[model samples]
Target chain A: MARVIAREGQERRVDGIGQGDHLCLVYADDAEQRRVVTAYVRAGLSRGERVLYFADARAPREVLGWLRAEGVDPSTALTTGQLSVTTAAVGYLAFGAFDAHAVAQTLQAEVSDALSAGFTGLRVSGEMSWALRDVPGADQLGTYETAVNAVFAGQPASAICQYDARRFSAAALDDTQRRHPGTVELAPLHLNSRLRVTPSFRCGQRMLRVQGTVDHHTIAAFAATLETVLGWPGDVWVDLGELEFIDLAGLRALAQTAARLPAGRRMHLVELAPLLCQVVNLAEFDDISSLTVTARDAA
Target chain B: MTDPAGPRLPSSRRLTHQALIYGSDEEFLAATVPFCLDGVDQGDSLLVITTAGNTDLLREALRDAVNKVEFLASEEWYGTPGSALGACHRVVDQQVAVGEHRRMRVIGEPLWHGRDAVETAEWTRYESAINLAFAACPAWMICPYDTRLVPEAVIADARRTHPELAVGASTRSSPDYVDPAATTGFWERRIAPLPADGDGDAAVLDFDADLAAVRVFVARTAAALGVSPDGVGRLVFSVNEIATNALQHGGAGRLTMRLAGRRLVCDVANPSRRATDWFLGYRPPGPGQERGYGLWAVRQLCRLVEIDTSDGVTTVRLHVDLD
Candidate 1:
């Protein structure tokens, strides 16, 4: 009976996700996908829920391997029928088509079967790229996603719809994002009313993406995030493409982080707004050898 | 008097602020051309901020030596007293860091033709402040005041502001000179009050401990007044800094915003009656210094920033010109 709704401009943590929550995860790359999938599967299995994954971009064995790497033993669950991993072709595009009502019925049946089998409920995750294969009625993916909300409503069932940002068109991503009530984001290093600092690892690079304002009210969060990111191995990159504002205190936090970086490791600031670029330059942050700033052209 | 090497003004390792009063083109060139050439001879980095006419005259008079000096028009350089102070500090700091120059010599002529009473007073305060703001840097600045074009009252104020007065080839200590520490308090005591919000059209917000709401109020209000996106960004930044200070230092505050002609004015007032420093934001913080940057940045971002404390309330007024 747990329902989670992510407010606009906010994201929900994967661990805090509950039954009756319909979440969409737009992953930047394979590393990010593996991390979230492992956490989601582990969370479900620990709670005795029947965990299901419909893998499209990754093989079923590869998905299980991620669970094993994250210290979750999927073998017992797989053997006991408490966990299932299949291709999206078999699970979603069954019978050569995707119909919204049919998918809703299929999801409801799974939830019912899990309860009858003595498991707590059902937790499902599907890699959504298979819909792009031109299968019959595949264009109804949005309809299916929206319809499944009712299938999970007041029921012990939840879902995570995964879309790879690299392959999906902007319109598709936007359409899918609006159909879900929540989004699965990694547990942020920091979050407050005015700012969100979410961390991600892609292509072996640690990154922190900042969104919203970083001023006196939010400098503590921003500074703390920078401190956490700096503690990680290798160089760090902060993506500020969605950042609406950052003040002197925020800049000071960045400077302090850059200064604290060990020799040979640099803090890379990418997609900085033009106004912020002016502020950084005025602060003379360029003097910090460990820091590099690149301004994204104004849209 | 036509030594071509300029008057041998006192050369101090510390800052030397002088007023060069000239009545005619001959006198202006006679003082400035020699000042530039002499600074160049002494390996000092030279910057000349003056009227377009004076820039041309100095350029012609210096001939080959003019290339060694950086020239900026006064209208563009003197955007506000705070900004002008920031600009001068940058020039001096850059020169000092390069180690290629012994000192920085500037010919700064403030724009005074179209200023109101408040602006005139602020500019006069700026002249006084240069004495303290650059007291540590090896900068020798000459503020040129044209007797015919500048108001007689402003010309009189200049004598009191500048520690040294230069007329043609003669240089002498100005008996009218007042120390910045003394004048700063005097100016603050006599600081002009903002015009009455007579129309009741001004947007007002009472804020306490909510810096974010303060920012939103300023941004929306400035945009409603037709401030450009960039202008709105700057206004929000400036106002947010002041409001944050108000909340932290004064416990709470109120904000009033109104448009005066094409310029947007925002005043943040708090009940804390502590004496505010008139020169708080003039000097930039040193490298790696954490505090004191908020106010400095506010001055840099806004068109004009005035701090007034009177009648049991302290107010920080910020102005931004709308596009």
Candidate 2:
């Protein structure tokens, strides 16, 4: 069975990527993105799969040139119809704005074409940096990304959606990661050990008590707790009295999760540090109706 | 057409102005249209200056009512703070020259997306200068900024500069608002110098012609300090942006990284006197526009950043909390 390349040289079984496997690849910049693509494409070619690269931020020629520089003979692959590179307009933005249905149909066609040409399967990768623009249908991107997962269901094609952390907003990156099952986490893995998240049920409300440091590294732990609270029946409260530090990403995670609550359900931030509350106010997170923030000093 | 009994401004001068901080287009349109229509119906001349995207949005929302409004591009009207203040004075003076109305209504959004460091600082100064520039004028100006696009620091400054805040259906006096006179010396104190040696020895690396090598050097140093993998990634990216700016503007520079009081501090020093502004990445970029996102990206990734220039040397210090 063929496998998909995960990182610089790591490969996972085909089951890990096929049958409608959609991967959210988050990169920092052009250099980082190029490194990931080189690995992905080389792995696909070695697996006898037809590869398709959609150029959004860069031109097709530049992508081809980069691929060539990475030791992948894109020209020979193109001549043999084993590799194809096109613009985002052709693949993703078929109708001037990205239509999920159109993109899925195009992917279906590419997959069929690849199989008919004697290739075992298809691998498609697209740069999502274009979505950051004021395109007509850009607001529907979250829906489109979610729909793509279902659109490619049961297909042999393995698709990867690439987002540059530098280009896209932190909110967009967070939303994108949640929409896909498999994610390349941009948050640093080795977190500060002082971080502590204790989830408890108090008076029929889901409460999460966070302590020590809460930055990008440990935001996932808080987010997981929030996910559970968001699904609950009543109100949720996050106690931050013991939190010595919390970065912007951590605060955003709380705000985003609070904003996701169902109507009439609220997320109350109880006992927030004075300085942390000020940062939230500065960022206007306090303006969110679903979230009622009360500073510890005020109380 | 001015009603004797209508929503009155707090100022004794009958001037009503505020900053419209909105997250999306819908919020922007909802808050702006009602305000503009209220002015237009009152028979006041409305001046709307912003980016092309916002101009189109306002026009579409106002539809036939746009004819009564004078819309100017932000770059043309007030590209720089000094120039913008002069233009503002000219607009107020010209309106005062008309004598057709006692009060002129205006909406100025001079700072939006894609501003360099100097432009952001000057524009922020201009925002503060507005209170003085039109201190006694009967002109009421409301500035609209997209929260999704603008930086939080700029938005915070907007609150401090503008005396009022406008939301969906109501406008209220801003509690965070400080007198513009009190904030006059803001630019001078924007960045303060850090101490030479705080706790630990700093790792300094001079970079030129090799960003990748610099990334490796920072990575090794940051890893030794036990920085998180994600923090390391952002540090590398921040250093890259700072280094790129240094190389482009000042030929070559040195980057110093050290842990200070639970914060990883990295300073990029160069031989340029041009100081970067506080609003480097305040606004998010629209698609198809790729440049000018470098420093802004750095601001987004790091916890806090301070840029200073003194004696022909410019330094940008990026902090990432390790605790």
Candidate 3:
């Protein structure tokens, strides 16, 4: 039986990912993509899996260079056929058109080949920027992504579909995220059964995206994440769009963070649920000079 | 003897909890209108919370001076004693922060008609506890009790709760007043015990450290009992806060949950026999303050929260109306 990877609908670090897991890697920029892809390929090679990368925006040579710079020698694996770096033109669009079923079949074939060739599993990651180029039948990207899950089902194979947020529309990103079983997040600042706190820096703004519940049990981790995010220079933003619930202790943590911010810095909380908004307002959090809260737009 | 003008407020820069007992609307105005006008002249922020009819009476009587006085219906203002107190504290805090008002003069007539004996007693305790909750603040609050509308027993309790009484322009120190500090036992009086739990009718869980389980238990049980989604959320939040406090202060706790009529009552009890401050959740924590907000927020979220420290345990019962 194929071993299950990270729990479905939860976030996993690049290294925690395993065979039978299908993940979406949404990168804000090249730095983020390089970090995740490097860790992912390194982990795969170390685990004796056949690792493959279909480079789109970056040349295959550049992708190899990133691995080498990260202290991983890809030349030996390249010679042994355990590592392969190709281009989307030669792999996904080999027939001069995108086909969801064809690609899924190809993926299944790769998994079988890797298993037959004395490898433990097949680990593949593809730069999905090709879908943004208006390729014929490229609109079926979500369909292809969804179909890939079936190929990975009960098979020794895993895939990470990387989408550059800068290149993908918000709707496209959201759709892809929904289709994937799990997302690759930065090694989370905090993760437990009750709450998950992940930090990301985009465009000079540091943000912590909190999901699950934050009550007294998880408040210490949540508070520590706030402290780490607040340590970064400039204003901090917390995205509570995915947050299910936050109690008074969590609110107090936000208030304490705002109180401790240096002069001229503020904390912006956005996409709050209506109930959380009501609590924040009831607690008079708005009276805190360095704090700002924006409720999620009603559905 | 009292000044014909109206009640004379004390000059001390501290809170004064007073009662205004009146028989008619004219008498109510005779005592309140001049009090509000004088507050306006003194640059004090005035907050009048009364019945709609009385609000109209005060508005019509205050005339142009009405704008200076913020009016809120008593029904809306008195959700729970703790929440009402929290709201009043917020108003006073804001006024103090602005530095524009010399004092806060509030004409608060608590809703008395529909309350059961338990609720009336709690509200009465609230009236007395306000003295301690706002001891240092410059606020003069007069709670009016209508002779015709208020039950005689409640009016009698009002004298014990209020330090001063105003009866148609005659202001005097209430002979029956019991100082909150001197009667700390009265303030921490044991709340009525919850009825014995039915075999399987109540969902009970004992929690020592994991507040998350407490939340899940509450959300599930509340929803199972037919609480609306929003109500479930609130009950979970409130219960989690109380449970957190219990674990932190009392070491471990047990939760008993059951539905009484249309209300979902959850009791969180701990082994500690220590007396709980009656004003525990009645005051908001100041900025940068961390320890005092949990219970305050719980009180704001629940319909009514009663903290009882008797029978060798401290029980904080949270009530949420399922309807």
Candidate 4:
């Protein structure tokens, strides 16, 4: 079980990294990420671990400059084969697309290679900003992150997965953070709760647009927003296109909300993933005598 | 007319088909009670399947022998001829196993009132088909018709179905009784033939793999027929099961949907060698069973479910009441 290694104060430093430790660093800007990465890499180098950084949002030379600013000699580390900085295109996208198992296997093999080459351990940090380009299988990024927990367990390796919050949806950020055992928040701007629920009236109909996750942490906000929407005029259309994940509790909340609607108004759930559709269908939500809940794909 | 409580006379017959035509409740009792009592005296299994009104009458007449007889609810147990026959066979098999070769008596009174033309036709065919259903078994069945309530045509159909007629306690051969196979053939020939185009009010969907389209089509058709919102969903859920079963076991199939009076009916026909068994969907699925709920859900949701097999094609009819 890896614990949080970053302190909650000014000059936050990432430390205490050991074998089988997996950490995530979420940032809002490249300028703020430098301090966190520099501290993280220096901690590994001081422990004689081979450092591998897959940079995508910034060039390798620019990242080296950041390391130099942290009082580390980049030229010496580069020449001594102790550190390697490569672009995301060459490192993460070696297969031209990301597959959850393939990525995890590749990283595991790399860790084994580093251990065989006489390094005490392997330290890896990859910038996930490349996922914003809509690459095939990018939607599996969260699944890959979750898989890494088993990959690094009891292995002589530690990983810091960096994601630029500005380049990803709050849902993606929330999902990524939820999968990692530890996270170092470099910018407080993106630290807000990852749930945005808004209710409004459109053409005499009550409507709600839901984004991010609807889990235990954000169910209350969802319930409150739903109540506000139900108070408005005729019928309801809930656009769930932006909703990334929903738990059973969240689904129950929706069912209860629909049950309490005014007479003659129907609730339409539009644009749900296939798995979500199966969950909704299996529940027989529309069979509730008091409510008219219809699930359909957006026309 | 012979005395209702007259002394019993021993008889030897392979399969006894007796139809009792009665004018009043007393007459119905006189004819049916003797048949049931004779079975009890012979130490044979007796099963009485009839309406609640007649069940009470027979229970009182059976007196102390009521415990020895088994009564099944006719409304729930009798749906289509095929299903009713299936239920009768199950009861007969159980009773026969207990009685050995003593004999088995079944008094099946499938109500002939308030049924639509389609149901009436089906029951009429059932009456004829039962001869074939029990030809090889040593079962004595007495079908009672209320002369004051049942239509004249129904009585005539009964005459054609049974080999003998019973009034009071007397039995006589029926001139109208045709061979069981001939009776079965006559009724099958009278069933409404499938349309040549198969595309009038009925929309034909040849479904081999896709189940979603079946659901969508059922929903749209049910909604158009003014089925309640909950009814539409339930109908879709149930029809989805039927379509799935047809695809998996019934082989290549086509679903035909149309409005029959105030009811929405969908017929799923497949080129399978066997018909969907009657008891397939009428019972709860057992533990660890994965593939039995499809037809059972259909039975739960639809108002009427019937299966018929003819000339290598199996058709399952799903009827949802619009009112």
Candidate 5:
């Protein structure tokens, strides 16, 4: 917020607050909340601003339908689905809400997306239409701004910058280093919370493109994406140079991925994970090796 | 009782043929598939037994050195000679039937273990073993180093020991001992050639697994396929793995192979299972790695890997290109 204000020389309100690029709001409600929030967003739509909406899967369709009728294409808005609390938050960074409504049944939960859903302090600091309810830590002074900045800056792939211990678990991170070669690391601050996430579209040389641990949890997504990317009906580099852990599940996923590719597409593994290399040999996967991954030089 | 394992029922087909020997041991391995190799052939139901289960030595001689034995279990015969003979007899009887294409081959280096092994009275037992094997043996050949030590009287008393095989030990050559009286099948050669060359079936091969023997077996097959022996030794050892598995599991299974197109396609099917991933031919790390290493070895050496398992049928095929 400060960078945006400083760089743009935006005016600060006399109420001891800085003007910000984005605005958000939170409120505690009992009922009749929908009418109020929809009105707020309708105001923005009437102003002819392209509004983006973000909400849980079962959010009220009427509010979104109203926005769509006003002209925002539904596809442009992203869905975080039911990702973890932190992931949902990072998604929010990209998927900032217009007049979105996310209502959880229980406010406090064992594993709820509440930690990353705070919008409590933006009302006085900036001017924007915000109508959220019982945001976990909404009353904090500048906490909301800082959380928003995290996603705006430190762009970890797929991970929404909130907090997580796995980000810098000495053992897991160290293990990653042992197998992978790299120096500069923006490690997680703790077990569950990341330092911050500020995503950039820039594909930088300093980017440590990591090969993720391929397990049942991620195999389908991994393979389908690989296949889709390869089947782009045009040229695309499905770079897998930095993948680390690949178990049997991962191997099968890769095999399935290669099998699904259009024949003679020239797929290459380009420095495949150790176990994947073995799968290639045993299953005669090389029969379509040109269309999948190929081992690349170890740098 | 008599050793029931010898060529019993003479082949109604009445096929007569000469021994076909290739120049190299590997050539013999490739050209010598069960049911037919060069001038020899075994029927579909072929049982193989080998007392010498030295996998290392067999690898050196067998064509599918590792891939052949990759997925099956293999072990040396630890039971008594009599029981081993009994086992052989049972295998023969179980497979060989009247008008059935049953053939069994038993190969081992002959050793005078004790009086129990080569006693003159044991001739009946030896004859029974051969009779049982040959009863179903479409065409059988045994490569025992010396049966000469066993007295002629012992062999004579046996049910079907080649009575006229000059009844003596190593006086001349270690002549191959065969009895056509056991499951003889006539091939009308020029008149009635083979069944169009590609009647493929699952097969199992169990042989005395000596590394040298393994090498000998592999070299025979390689030479038959006419592939230049440049770095093919690895392929040879790879195929041996399947053979080792057959030996350890099937007790006796034939190495059934056919020359399909440019490929010397062979399979060593066994009634055993080794569920390990060995796509890279290296020393398998498990207990069965010796033969379990076959899958990995096969993947490395062959052009294709086709494994079909259904009901009780398991076949592992490795195609070695002749060109």
Candidate 6:
């Protein structure tokens, strides 16, 4: 590992995404900086990199437009080109409304395609920041790590790496180890991701503690995580206290699932950021006393 | 109104799916009454299931003909995938028994999805044997005055799945359809307020015809709203589209004059889809793309064009502000 000078006493939290000697992304200002990032992405693609990107924001236009121009229609073909780009705003409006599994299946399908394509480097932009907040799965850094290693398994040394500014709990490290062993962990990538989900376990209740932007990608993960945790034998409490944004999809998912959870299963969401809670109320998810997006800062 | 190439419609001897490509569903039913009476003369049983309560139109259109009605129930949200598959299986089983030599043809362009998918898909999804079975006899369709919304995918998939299936389109058209692109804006500008505050599956609104002319239906609608519409070239592309939804969807298709707040609104109450998409507004032949922007054009034009489709009735209110 190359040692670099630290910025005083500041400890930067980052999500990791690596494939071989290259990394997923690092903060870049313009085309020049992006070139450095693109070089690695291109190299990964050369090695058959399966890249999945959800443009959750607008800034990532240049990168996404390039991919979309390259003929990446993820909805139809089970397999897109080695790379694919999708936008949440467009997705919602395209079908004229929200369809959750349709959106989620898009990624699951992309990842599966990437594995088949044997794609190496996957570069994503847009709401990568918000993806880190509530649903820090594929759209965020967490998924990047899993995908990189899965796609580049048993490849040459230095053929894989992970870099993201979004950090989950150090405890998830244990879960990562227990679930996905042998995948080397890389240092966190430091960038300006809007929202960050710092996961942690409290009193045996698995809490997906969030801190940052709350968008469509993260929202789906929250519901998915809850569904995942329900299969386990513990009372789960999801604390979105530090979250910043919550769109319609996020609010609806939490409300719908919370409404019909079994008696054995109790979900209590605590600490919602102002904007986030309002969406929950608007979508009517908070009406369920079982689920709470209260006002408090935890992260 | 079908050619004599395939089996005649409303044939009682054949207990099978009969699909008729008619001018409209109403026209199909109108022809079906005469056709079924002929079938009755041949000594066979007939069962009619309608999703809409307007079967009275079928009765009235028949000109007082004697026809037996087993039951009339709504076939809208009727079955599931499993049930659909079950129904298809039975339909297929019966088709197989008819003869290994004769072809079985599945007919009718029915609008189907979800709970309605079973029966709809049966008429839609193509199985080789079913196609062969239906190839011998097909459904006789009637719709000289009805507007139907069917998913494009169903047709294509059926064609691809069953290349042997024969389907055709009717040349007749309806007149109630208001082209969303060119006419909506012109309505809001000159038309007045709506009256029927009564609520239900549909909302009935009225507008003045004297203030607005049908010749300016496209330009005036947009001009009245003081807004420029894109693809105004697609306005009222056909008279069939303009009329079908009016009678079939809303119940009637004619210009009405009503007063709302000193404003004379010339409203046309017709059945329109919850969506503004119509076959006529299409750009040549592209689908599910920038072509479906016609409704968006309508939404932008009308001052208060409300679409209320709750029960089964769908009434679209196009308000043209008249001071």
Highest DockQ: give the candidate number. 3
Give the residue spans of candidate 6 off by over 4 A: A1-195, A217-226, A257-261, A274-278, A287-290, A297-299, B1-323
TM value for model 6: 0.21
Q: In model 1, what are the clashing residue pairs, if there are any?
A: none
Runs in model 2 lying further than 4 Å from the true structure? A1-299, B1-160, B163-185, B286-290
Q: Backbone collision count in every prediction?
A: 0, 7, 0, 0, 121, 87
DockQ of 3: 0.40
Find the 10 residues in a row with the least total lDDT in model 4 chain A: A1-10
Candidate 5 structure quality by residue, lDDT tens digits, A1-299:
00100011121111222212222221112122233334444443333322233333214364456446656544333242211112223233223432122211111121123224331111111111122234443333133433343332222111111111212232322222232111112321111121121110001111112244443234445544454344333222333444434433344445555556566544334455443464455433454444445555444
Give the least accurate 10-residue stretch of model 6 chain B, judged by summed lDDT: B278-287
| Residue B69's lDDT in candidate 5 | 31
The models' CA-based lDDT, in order, is 0.81, 0.69, 0.82, 0.68, 0.35, 0.38
Q: Which stretches of candidate 4 lie over 4 Å from their true place?
A: A1-299, B1-14, B79-82, B97-101, B189-216, B219-254, B267-318
lDDT of 5 at B26: 40
**TM-scores, one per candidate:** 0.73, 0.31, 0.75, 0.43, 0.24, 0.21
Poorest 10 consecutive residues of model 5 chain B by lDDT?
Answer: B185-194
- DockQ values for all predictions? 0.34, 0.01, 0.40, 0.02, 0.01, 0.03
Clashing pairs in 2: A133-B287, A188-B230, B149-B283, B149-B284, B150-B282, B151-B282, B281-B296
Model 3 residue pairs with clashes: none
Model 1 agreement with the true structure over B122-149: per-residue lDDT tens digits: 7888898787677767788899998999
Model 2 lDDT tens row, A1-299: 01111112112222345546777776554665676677777777878899988889888888888778977787778999888888877777879887766777677788889889999889988888777877878788898888777656677778878886657765676577667766532222223575766543322234566767654345567667567666656666777877765655577678878888988888888777555575565444665779888777543
Residues B82-149, candidate 6, lDDT per residue (tens digit)?
22223333444444555432322222223353423323433332221232233334232221112344
Q: Which pairs of residues collide in model 4? A: none
Evaluation by TM-score, superior candidate among 4 and 5? 4
Q: What is the lDDT of residue B226 in candidate 4?
A: 76
